[model samples]
Target: MPAQPDLRSSEPQRGGLSATQQALDAQTALLPYALAVFTVSLPAYVWAGSHAPNAVWMSATFAIFAAAWAAFYGAVNWLKKPEAATDLKMRGRVQIFCALIWALAVGQIAFFADGAGAAREPLLLTAVAAAVVVIFFASPWLPSLLIVGPAAAAGPLIALFAQPETRELASLSWGAIALSMALALIFNRVLRRQFEMAAERETLIADRAGMVEAARRLAQSKSDLVATLSHEIRNGLTGVAHVLAAAAGRNGRGAPSREQLSAALDAANDLISVLNTTLDSETAEAGRLSVEARPFDAVNLLRDLVLLNRPNATAKGLELALHVSDDLASAKTGAALADAHRARQILANLIGNAVKFTVRGRVEARIEQTLSGRIAIEIADTGPGLAAEEMERAFEPFLRVERTSAGTSGAGLGLSLSRQLARLMGGDLTAHSAVGVGSCFRLELPYDPEATAEREVVQAEVSTTPDPADRKALRVLIAEDDGLNAAMLRAVLEQLGHHVVHAVDGRRAFELAKAIEFDLIMIDGRMPNMDGPQTIAAIRALTGHGGQPPIIAVIGGDAEEAMDCTAAGADAVLRKPVSVGAVARAVADAISAGRSEPENRVVA
Candidate 1:
């Protein structure tokens, strides 16, 4: 059996009871004392009035007992005060005071009964009973026991011993005293146990409440995760649909030119990037995302972002402008240590949003170095700007701001992911906007010129010749399970002037590949009968005539897929929502690499 947790440890040591319980305890503790005063005072006043050495002594004794009762009443009132309720010391003092007053009343009764002889027995018995009641009520309090215990035991003896004929009553009085003391100890134990049990119960209740609150938060987090995934996946599907429709010439429009098809492909790729960024944000929230800092030129990065979005701005009849500080432009090295990819992602999101939301006016990007050697990039747009209240909420995932212009709306993860990426790189993204004006997003990143080092530059030969419209077409094989994706792939390949053969599953594709000699084979990562990696392995193991055709694995935009495809003997990997340009590049690169190797030979 598992060991149980000690709940007593969780209970507060001082005043742990709720207000109602404390009030009840206070009343119970004071009740017995009040009753004892009444029980003893009435008899004392009668005795003094009937049998007194003098009227003056009788009046004085009666007056003293009355005053003691009044003082006890005042102490009870003091304990009842709201300020005194939580004061443990004050409560202890009040209990002690009550005990003392009780002791005094018992002592006084014994004094008056001493001279009354046999008549004093009833008075002494009454005093003993009152002491027992007070001790019983006060047992819950430790201080009360310390003061009242001895007084209760000794009060009866005062009257018994003071009598000259206490010989017969002495034994009986001692037994009563012993019995009262025993009851006090027993009741004290019981009361202490009660308090401990109550405290334990309170502790368990508090723990249960905490667990409930935690469970609620976890459920809410799960809900948010589902919402984010649904929104982003829908956006990705929309991008895929737009690109495919354009490739198939099904938009009730003329055939899309190569540039338009390329733009659509770029849009699809951007959607994939957004999904990857969302994953990055999740990793960041879990504290697992790490930054890869290296030396990079900030000027070149900003220039690229401006150029990339310039088309979008122009298409919308909006001016795109860039302003770079002279100092930054003229810096000898112009290098900064940062995560260049993440920085680009943040800027892309900001610039993309600016272009998407704006209609007629210009979008301007400004770059400069701060006094503290930090780089600040600001993108200002004349879009229907965000309202003041919408500014902060804009960064919350799945929260989309309503715009006046009927432009495309997103999953609202872009800004949130961008801000998280910026902060992870030891930078921050902030925004300033007004209702009718415009919005400006500022990105601030640490810039360390002192740590800047010389970076190696590699240049590639540029090709200015236009692509030929009548290149040699090759036989291409495609294995995909998704119907829409297969159709899209076929459309792209045919548009590239290639003869295409489609297989619904990898098993059929492998069989067809063995029968026919094809120039290229494309396999989807997830397909019926066999996955892309398994199919690649099977194809590589096959005995072929003209060597195995160059194989390309089409997969989701994930690092794991790329690694798996490479490990499985694929020549190249293409991320899905495949475009004509990507397919052409993959084929050209694979065939070029194949030409350098012997025919009918697997490299591995």
Candidate 2:
């Protein structure tokens, strides 16, 4: 078996070939050398025709045409590659093609020189022919045999019948013919071997690419299978979780044993996690992960990450710290885009492993400016470092070295997902580690200065004393699809003392909007027959509902999906697993904002 690669470290390939370009460059290098050695009488360019009438009019045409054919053959060889070849080699092939044509072109210009054709004809033709014959026998070709074989059998007859110089001179011509044939025969065999070697090298390269492509397709197929199964499982689990909770609630607490209930809940949570991660892996592999770029404070985002991970890090006895580098202001451009959740995942994975592996030593996160003006985020852990072999295999999917803490394990898709996410956002992940020495993982990303300014979301302070004005009942319209989920939601809304009216889906939601006046519309993001956003847009198109309902999107997807709802006229968005208090607050706000001045409609 081949040795496993150290994925954690990639000393980015020398010429920056992202796998595709390197292939083309390899073939380009061979074209020029092939062209130079095949110089002939007639030639012009890679896509152009030959020099002049005189140059190709003679037998020298055969030599020039051979060189031209080789250049075309070499070029097509490179073009079929998966990636474009880069740098000097790409240009060199064209140069050699042009130079060969230029050499033939000079022969044409010499046609105009006085007495040149007569004086140069015998010497130049013979000299060039001698070189060709020498090179042929020295490095012969398959086709050269036809030219050499016949010349050997006809030499003596030609001298005696045609030339008739001195008898001695005829004998010399015969000998010259024999020598030429001997050399050409030997050279053709050598040429045959050289061509075979080149062909083998080409075949090897092609086979390697085929393997890589097959691996890619196999990976894609696996991701699709995971995604399909995850979706099917999740649809089942959503109903199961809610039904179990409802059943447990109605069971008077003691019907099912506490241990049994607890075990069930734990299994549900684990399944949910597996489903979410599988979805992430599948979407990421398909390159379907989309980002919603909104302005949000960089420092605040960092603080949120630290706060969000605080509970887990604390439970693991890990030291988690957040630091901000001041140089993020330098990456000034609308050109830069980073998915905040992706960054969080990338960082969380690094920090999570750091804390999980380090038994007693510290895990620290340090933020600093990268040399390239991008943000450099590092998570370092003082744990047992990896062996040289293990280091390379760390980031590869489904690979775990077993050098870390016993329970610190995952499907191995996490780091691969993390790295690809970083690259998609114009950043890269790299790690530095030595045997017995701690490891440092670094992520460099383009920082957008404007995102911090645009996303200003700070929770408003809540007063301890409830005001009489806050007691107002609000009119709410629930647009949900699943009958069971809707019932669960209505119970929560009705308990909060809000008047609730329900719609089956987007079509019914639109009908409900057209017929009656409501303070708020709790619209489901994904609904058959027009969807939530479409329903909201239809409502917005009409003049008034007496008071315009502030539509809150009950989203089934992530924040990026929520952004699309907001753009389509939703006032706010909440995910499907929204808690009771969150729904009540949304209802309260929408009602207060959309209420008529003095209409007392049981108005909370």
Candidate 3:
């Protein structure tokens, strides 16, 4: 039976290939050289034997040589296999065995030829030629040369040394063997060096290709980002500007109806969401994303998102429903300690995605508490689901699964950012889907039983909605760069019965604050002459009572901008695309916080 190849010879070397493996490759590449030599030499030996005096012995030697060559050929073919070729030790053994067989065939001719004087020169020359050929064949693996080199020369050297008259021929053969072995070692080094250089060149080429592909992908990503943002922002702003123009009677039209305003609000909110998601993704990539964790009713938040997304679902002719687990509903508390705003954001994204993708079937939002005290929300949709590969790619930033006809609208950041926000709050977001069935996205958050119990009691005592009329109207000062934004702020504040004073920039606002005692100061983060933080710092530096009013920073950038405002001693921060309720809440919170911590200041 053929010997099985050694499967556990050694570990792989650099580039995931071993020296033995490389040598095997060289051996396979050089096999044709051996075959060519054998093809020519066997016929030449047969023709030479026809004229020799001891033609019988010559015929026997030729038979031995031919048989040895045939056996070597078979072994070389077997070694061409993937498993057998890499075994350096096995190939070395085969080399020694084949060399011994050829040595024996040559020794028969050297020892038993008829005329010693006539054969001495030719026999010595034959030994030298065999040694050279063996050296060439064994050069791929150095260990094989150690035995094959000596074996090829041993027979001729012994036969010549046995005759007293031909000691000189033996010395000549010995010198030839020594030179051939030395040259074999050098040739082996050259062969290995050439192989290494080729491997390195291939590796460098591969690396260059990889880098080029990565750069191309990056450029494509940038282009896609620019195109998506341009389309979404233009559409959103067009809706908002049209609504505002109609409401202000700029087109000589009556006041816009409630539904038109709501549509505009939705467009503006969608635009804000895209911007916020992009910022959040960047912050998360920088490892600086944070969450403001507090106790809130997660079930109620989910229900609110369902209601918020119902319009979109209805427009798509899809049924949207919310399901609460029996345990959670009976307990009357599905509270969680996390960033409530972030929770709302994540649910809104999931629900929005479900509604957008589902063509005609239903979208369901299910909330339940697990036995391990974790809250899980599942957003399942009867949409054309994603395959395994697509599902995996769905959470990659800037990637969108657009297998449906619902045109890709908005930046592809919803799932990626939602997952980041989920994990930041000690939770995770995952999905399960089949290609034609549907998709279900699960969002899990760490649950606090104590928070749930506390939330139930608090919910019973405190109303989630606050009345703006219950508080005393404030003298508010607004520092805004845009005239339209300033007008909107003034209108919202005045409707809540607050006296409004508007300044075009931070410098003018600062002058007004020094002249009059305002109840609250609302400052936009970016303005000419002075930014939000600079103005806040300058105001807080005042020695008189002018800087004592509650100051709110209206940030339109990222969390870093809010941090800057906080560091500059702002009482509170209000993000842009703000609503009337948000403004009123910010005002009330700033006043309450100012009264509680009048000397609170963060050094910048």
Candidate 4:
């Protein structure tokens, strides 16, 4: 059994609940202490009232004690009860409101003590007062306390000074407050420093964790790359070696019949298929993928993909089916130019995996839009299904599971790379599987808002295969800045049977176009002086050269980048390092289409 993955995850939100809950619990635990402060101070008010000489003074004293009792416990219970837990902003606001109340309660006791006929004993409230002093001295909000406590005390303290008879003997009280204020200030300064240190520590810890995650992800990508390379090289070389070895063994023993040669050829062809697929995957992963977004029918692409996969499924004796929503069909039929190449790659991975795995039952693919506004593709395979363990592991690199009676062949990089490719195209791939119920993989792509067709034309003096009557007898001009690439194309094109000409850049290609009549013009997308598109646009503007050569663009970067190539004037684009056959075919098609009257011939 493969190792199980822990799926519970943490959110990257600020002031997360863990920290807030901790602070709340600490505040709550101090509730009993707050309650005790007012409770103890009750007796202090009673005694002071009894010692009062007049009814007014005695009543004043009584109200002071009651106020102390109510205020202190009110603060306690407020802190104890849970506030708006989900609202961090509200918690902050509550902190300020409660702090203000604390200031008011403390101020009343300080300023009105002598006015309310003086408490005879002040001992009851001493412990809590001292405790509060100790806690607030080093509290994170100590600096703020200096302003609040003093601000609240200032108003009534001024009035108290005017009323000499009531406040004249409160010398000790004034001195104590002045001293507490001084102590609070010192404590606050120290707390500010500590808070700074703690904050720095937290930031350092977070940075460290971020670095660790980055490292882990890099390691995973590297391993994935290695696994992909391993699968490609090992599979290709192994197949090729076996074919050669079998052929050699047969010849050494006895001359093999027609059957052996055919089998050997078939095996060799399989290796070529693997090599092509692997190269495509590598090119994509290496960020060398080229795609042309022309309004092609999505229905057509889907049709081709289904037809290609159906035979494989049939051979596996697994039912294959497809259902494309009408909306999806509408979106596809010459409505948008998407990275249809990438879409095909994604489908290939899905169907390849499906056919590989299922021995009986069925593998199905469905493409439609969800109510949430997304293109959803679901590929489900009914094989032995996936165990809970294997389900998570299935998408991981090189993570092949033990087959149940019958299952897929090869390493498990297909799904992993496929999913990565999906995400790169602004989509997601997800899987659902149970032990005995098979697996369903879903891919969703945000619909492309702009589904414009690539209307640019690619014409070049393309080389043709060895055929006398239809050999490429036309002159083709090649424009490029790179000496080596120019030389290579000259050789490659001449060998392909097309007469080849050369130009260093746009100016040169333009001059050549004017000076000579060429059947096709090959343009490099990125040229120093005048780019292929600019040169082509210039050539089209010219009055001479009544016959416009077809233009084929050779591009190095993402061909799907519409801004670069579409506006660059490419008739039809081919990715960099153009193969002889593809170049020939593109050229044949362009010329056969007709090199008409100085039409737009451009390449970027």
Candidate 5:
């Protein structure tokens, strides 16, 4: 026969009660029914004792049975408390203990009734009924039933079988008791299965609801992001278009004033800043954001950011000030070994936000070296500040403060991306704000004195070299799929005095490279018909002087993509939104490096 599942089993189970917990619940339900049986049994015992030969002993036995039932009831009530409810082992032991007591008390009563012979049949029937009730309740947990069931039934059978006339009656009673216990076991199994099913159903419902809620939240977040981007982009482009139209005399204006030009530049820069921040946030989330740590002049970078932000501040009628600590002022160099690009990005965001929000009073930028030899920059503004709750969520991506007016435009990624960059560079960014009292943001970075001296020495050595502008004009090849981008690059190269050859794709650029030995090659990282890296690799595989020219990869991705371009034999990597000066310098550097290498050799 297959082994019966142990009703006493207590191994943990998910989405439903464990075996022990089920057993505890069974015992708890049985308590009230057991109490009623004991209450009625007391009166029957007293009446039987009055008509018995050993009446005094029977009465005393009845009193002890009452006391045991009282103790059992107390234990069950105690288990209802929060602390004691989970003690499954203790609860099981208590049920076993009570079962033993019940068996002894009822068995003795049945024996005494059979001996009295006055109310013999009636009392024996009552004892059997009481035992059957307990067996029904205790069946859910087999340990209790195993001891109590047989013992409760055995006492009456023995008493009746002792008399020759009652033996037939006892045989019939035995069959009924066996049938009752069987039914109880079957009922317990069916009920427990139902309970488990209910528990599982509840769990499934909860999980589905949670998934729906998460999907709803994500959809709402994306909608808000789209709305913010559209608003900011439209406003910025409108300002730039208006200024340019005026400058061209198309709007009946002779020439653009200095203020108009500055406003236009600021508007265009704002659009770029918003786009970069959005890209950085996505890159960071994908774990592809790279930090290139190097030594740079922190003091100079902060001064430039403050100077750039002053025009915006003055236009808003807000005072802007830059403060340097005595130590930093005397040293004249706040050198930090970190990601210079990301540091500039963080400080610019902080300063820009300070100026943009402060309608009156002043915006201040403070630079200092902490006692632990770390560089610290704090941007404070006298703006309509944020409340405690709003400040807490300031660094959350895509979160815009409700205090921002309709005129103020942003994509809500500046603070979030800035903080991520700070931590990536082995530093931190923090903020302090109070409603109506203004706000302050602090950025901290690692400092290195040796890097400062090294930078200064390199600067002095470079000062003695010939200017890149004095170099002779050279042939430059430009590979870009976008027409406007190619035109802009061609214009910049021509203005720099280099003869430029334009290719709409990498295939054309490769063909041009094979036919003509160019002094430099600038290719886009991504293009149709042949990507930048693939073209560069193919060019490098060519024979003779076809592959020897210096190659520069123009990318619009994070540092990981830049590394990919360089791996394919490119000499340098330049990111998109390139300026005239940046292009001129890249051209000069590539040409200078190419001249130093052998003609028939390829760079790898």
Candidate 6:
């Protein structure tokens, strides 16, 4: 037969039981003692009444038992109080006192058997048996065995010692005492095992509950992700469809202009940007998003953002204004260290949402430095303000508020992502509004006044724009796996008067570069056969290669991917789906920089 499993190894320690359960067990184990004291006193009173010769002695003994019983009952009630349950010292004292009382009662029974002769031997033995039963049920196992075991044996032994003729009764009493002791030991082991099992069961239940809660949260997160994704996809597709339909209408009437085509392309790019932002938000939620701290002009950044959204505001027939406080203007230097790109993204989201929701009145941006040397950018809008309940849940992801006016709908990630980005910069975003009143969203962030002067000196020599006359047409090689992206790059490059060649994969691009002398090589970070880095390494390894033709890496909007490409010898990196202007600028910079210094690589 197989050996039984050891329960002691698997169960929690005996002391691991909860405080409430331990108190309850202690109460349960002591209850029988409380009742036994009162019940056992009745026989003593009856014996004192029947035996007149020793009435005073019996009465005194009965009185003493009654007093002890009263004290014991009072102690039990005292211990039941909530505060008393935690008093270990008091509980120990009470247990000891009760044991003494039990011993004294056994002594009284033995005395009666001796004084009443052999006639009371049977009665005395019966009293001893009753005491043993009470002890077993009333007290914990260890105490019961120590106090009652000897008491049971002592009763009959004393009777036999006083009356030698009662030998048979004494012998039977000894057998009963031994049996009682064995039962007590078995009961203790069982009671301890049961308590341990109860503790283990409680722990298992708690762990199961925690797991259920975790699963519930995971399910909710997935549901939110699905809903947000669907909403965003539908909105993006709808915008693209509208743009295409408008362009088609213009084409049928006469001919669609360059502006019409540009508008359609811009709409498509905006959709891609939205998808990228959603991905970035998910990365932030997973605690994997990285923030870059660099010096930037906060005042100019805010002005550009406001200017960019001015067209949208104008189309809505609403006034858009920028208000910089006197203190900020006087400070002269607006440079601060922060994740400027992320900060701009957050501000843009707020301003865009404000412009979209407000049909009339004005949208205003206010920039100021607080007394604590922190920058505060507040965007206030005269839109249909949010209700109290709506404001409470305004920053919750995927939760969209119903507006009274008609406007473009979104996946409701803008505010949530904005708030997270703001907090990530050691600041916060807060909103205050009432129904029918204008709403204000404030973003506060830490600032460094000392960086401003140095930033101004640096900015003095930097050129914001490149001279168009200096732009040169060059032979550009494009290696991309996506057909649409490849076509777009070719068109954008050709429009700028640059000769273009397309390669379907990294290996094919490497083959093309070897066959022809191209001015610049543009490779996608991910492709078939070889990736961007592998292709870059292979090209650089060519014999007599002088790094003459700079390599440009086109990748998704992941910072890590961009960095990887730069580390792998790419001259520059442009995130997709990039604009025509962005691609043109990158190509021009790569060519110009290569001409100035043949070995130089520009990392963007």
TM-score of each: 0.54, 0.56, 0.65, 0.63, 0.67, 0.67
lDDT of 1 by residue, 351-438 (tens): 8888888877999999999998898999999888888778877888656675542345455677888888788788899999987789
User: Could you tell me the lDDT of residue 150 within candidate 3?
Assistant: 70
lDDT of 4 by residue, 280-336 (tens): 555766677655444434445555667777877888788888888777766533232
The most accurate candidate by lDDT is: 5
lDDT, model 2, position 390 = 80
Q: On residues 203-300, what C-alpha lDDT tens digit does candidate 5 reach at each position? A: 56666777788778768767766777788899999999999898788999688889989888878877877887787887886678888787788887
Residue 112 error, candidate 1, Å: 15
Candidate 6 wrong stretches, greater than 4 Å: 1-270, 293-295, 325-337, 370-373, 404-406, 449-470, 514-516, 541-548, 588-604
Clashes of 4: 15
Residue 83 CA error for candidate 6 (Å)?
A: 11
lDDT of each: 0.70, 0.56, 0.74, 0.59, 0.76, 0.70
Any residue pairs clashing in model 5, and if so which? none
The better-scoring model by TM-score among 4 and 6 is 6
Better of 2 and 5 by TM-score: 5
Clashes of each: 1, 23, 0, 15, 0, 0
* Candidate 3, residue 72: lDDT: 72
RMSD of each: 9.7, 14.2, 7.3, 9.2, 8.0, 8.5
Better of 1 and 4 by lDDT: 1
Candidates arranged by lDDT, highest first: 5, 3, 1, 6, 4, 2
Writing each residue's lDDT as its tens digit, candidate 6 over 123-170 gives 566555755665565434354445545654565467665656677777
Residue 509 displacement in candidate 2 (angstroms): 0.9
Better candidate number, 1 or 5, judged by TM-score: 5
